[model samples]
Target: MKKLLNYFFQGLLVVIPISVTIVVIYKIIFWIDGLLPFQLPVKLPGIGEVNIPGLGILTIVVGITIFGYFAKFFVANPFFLLLERLLERTPLLKIIYTSVKDLIEAFVGEKKRFNQPVLVTVNKESQVQRIGFITKNDLTEIGISNQKLAVYLPFSYGFNGQLVIVPSENVEKINASGTEMMKFVISGGVTEVD
Candidate 1:
């Protein structure tokens, strides 16, 4: 009975993650598909008009890509800049807008902030350390010491994190990709760092 239980536990370890991942993806695709508002059927070679699943997701992706391309080198760029300026002028909206924009830009913008993963020395006496990303390398403009750097230490199993000011010497650069390190940290170190 113990041997059988061991096998069952091992099986669960393999099956649960895959099952949950598949179900989540399936649900997300259907949710995005439902957001299309109107479904246009396409006629295939042999089959009659058929409504394709996930067409909305495809359309949204293509539309966003096209918009991004145009906005990069067209009149829309100035229009967006003006809109952004107007949003910045508003009191409460400015804070929320800028924060959200900065958060998104930090991850996917041209100047990616989380690319540099570092190991910060939390307790030098106990030789304890914590993993974090260097967000701001320079602090002179902010009146902080140049030797001190801004580090964002993400919490395990959550999207929130705390920012700390650490001495440059106390932070050691880790040789790994940001995405993998983020996954490793978010998974509470349970996921492999490959």
Candidate 2:
């Protein structure tokens, strides 16, 4: 009976999060579609107000396609360039646009490379070691060179931690992938790879 209860609880843990995530995504898409100027009037035979199946996804696809088309052509065009310059001059909108553009570029840009994970000693004793990801190597004109590493110290069932930057020499490269490290972190070091 105890074993069955444990399994049921574990199942609920997985299923609840998945269902919640799907519902949240659906609601967001529905809200965005509501804001659009036009929408398909044809409703499904069974579902009265749900519109067509996967219409939200279709709307997103169409919106992205239109945006891409406009960006490719209009961005370089003289008239559009003038409008863009005018918009950029606006203080409030410019700040918002610049911040959003930077965030988007960071996520989707080809030049962006993520920190590589390595093993580092955490506490006073070298015996206590933790996993860290190398952010970058900073070469300053002050004749001081330093390597930045982000260490994720996991706590509880989820990651509620800070990223610590340590020197390069303090860390040792582990022959493990990011996925394996994530699993280890999520399970609070209970999950180990042979």
Candidate 3:
């Protein structure tokens, strides 16, 4: 009975994560695919003039590529400037919008803030350290202390996180990639950083 239960548990551990990952990817693909003009589609070689699946995704990829090209060269487009000015006027909206935008940019923008993982010393005398992502390397941009760098520490096995600013000297940059570090943090070290 003990061996049988152990095997069952091991099997579950292998199956559940793989199943969830596949299911989530499938759902996300379909959700993005649903964003297209479902009624209109171009004719394909084998499919004829049918509204093929993943057309929406292809459209989005192309649209993003064009947008990125413009944004990279322009730096500050007129449309984006107008939107920023509009958001800044609204007190509540500005705060929410800026925070969300910064978060998104950190993850997938030119800045790529979270790519640098660090070991921050929380207790110097005790030598206590924590792993974190460097969200902001220069606090002076926000008119904060120049000696400090902002880091985001994620909770293990949870979505919760803490944002802190520590002295740059206390942070030792790690060799791990952002994706590997995030996986380790989220899995509470239960999963390997492969």
In TM-score terms, which candidate is top? 1
What is residue 86's positional error in candidate 1, in angstroms?
1.7
Q: Candidate 3: worst 10 consecutive residues by lDDT? A: 34-43
- Which candidate leads the pack in lDDT? 1
Question: Of 2 and 3, which scores higher on TM-score?
Answer: 3
Candidate 2 residues lying further than 4 Å off, grouped into runs, are: 43-50, 53-57, 111-194
Tens digit of lDDT per residue, candidate 2, span 88-161? 88999899877676546533654332335577777656578876555445535435455544455545466455
Compute the lDDT of residue 150 as modeled in candidate 1.
98
Local distance difference test, each candidate: 0.92, 0.67, 0.86
**lDDT at position 68, candidate 2:** 84
Q: How much lDDT does candidate 3 score?
A: 0.86
Q: Write the per-residue lDDT of candidate 3 for residues 17-80, one digit (tens) a residue.
A: 9999999887887889876656447788887887655668878999999988887887587888
Q: Model 3 compared with the native: what TM-score?
A: 0.69
The superposed Cα distance between candidate 2 and the true structure at residue 96, in angstroms, equals 1.3
